[model samples]
Target: MNNSSKAVVSFIVGAAVGVAVGYFLNSDKKDELVGKLRYQADKLKDKWKKKKDQFEDALENELA
Candidate 1:
């Protein structure tokens, strides 16, 4: 809670972030990981769209 403690924590976090960025930038599998992440995002979008459509249909049925 002190200023000195806060400074130390900030330094540690900055170091960790620098290390992570360096690793990702130097990693050979970065592209592969990105592709997988993108694929997962697309699948999630499709799933949400399907759920929304189903919810809308049910709502219309109830109102009818």
Candidate 2:
């Protein structure tokens, strides 16, 4: 698959795994667990977005 598609799939899979682990670890503190997960996910998403933009810019430059 292409780089963008692969990144999306990887993010989805990572999110699923994170949710499962959080649920198992904090069965009674679901809100807290979800909040932490959301924060981490957001940070990861921002990092990925920056990386993707950089990659695209490089590719465009290469083509140009």
Candidate 3:
């Protein structure tokens, strides 16, 4: 993409992040939101690790 397009995308992402931060800072349920986010992140991490291990096992079997 062109420089202008990159700049626009960056600005949009920064604005979105700023808005989310402002919401969390002002909201009373910040702890709940954080807890949910952490739970989801952990779930995703576990899934990724499982998939990675499965892939490695398959590769090892194929090589052997």
Candidate 4:
């Protein structure tokens, strides 16, 4: 929501997109790389979900 937070999210999304594009263009062993990327992405999503909830709660407390 805030500028800094927005910037961070934008950077992350941009990096992921860039990596995906590179991976598609460069990968020879597609299946193995896809599996690894999926696993890593899932891990990141889980971590992000935990942190996002914490940030929301903190923001709510600040507002309250």
Q: Pick the candidate with the highest TM-score.
A: 1
Model 2 weakest 10-residue run by lDDT: 22-31
RMSD of 1: 1.9
| Residue 42 accuracy (lDDT) in model 4 | 100
Model 3 earns a TM-score of: 0.63
- How close to the true structure is residue 41 of candidate 1, measured as C-alpha lDDT? 100
Could you tell which candidate, 1 or 2, scores higher by lDDT?
A: 1
Superposed by TM-score, candidate 3 places the C-alpha of residue 52 at a distance from the truth, in angstroms, of: 0.1
- The better candidate by TM-score, 1 or 4, is 1
Model 1: clashing residue pairs?
Answer: none
Tens digits of per-residue lDDT for model 4 on 20-49?
988777878787878899999999999999
Whole-model lDDT, candidate 1?
A: 0.98
User: How would you encode candidate 3's per-residue C-alpha lDDT over 1-64 as one tens digit per residue?
Assistant: 9999999999999999999999888998998888999999999999999999999999999999
Q: How accurate is candidate 3 locally (lDDT)?
A: 0.97
**Higher-lDDT candidate of 3 and 4:** 3
Query: Which candidate has the highest lDDT of all?
Result: 1
TM-score of each: 0.77, 0.54, 0.63, 0.50
* lDDT comparison, 1 vs 4, better candidate: 1
Reference-based TM-score, model 1: 0.77
Residue pair clashes in candidate 2: none
A best-first ranking of the candidates according to their lDDT comes to 1, 3, 4, 2
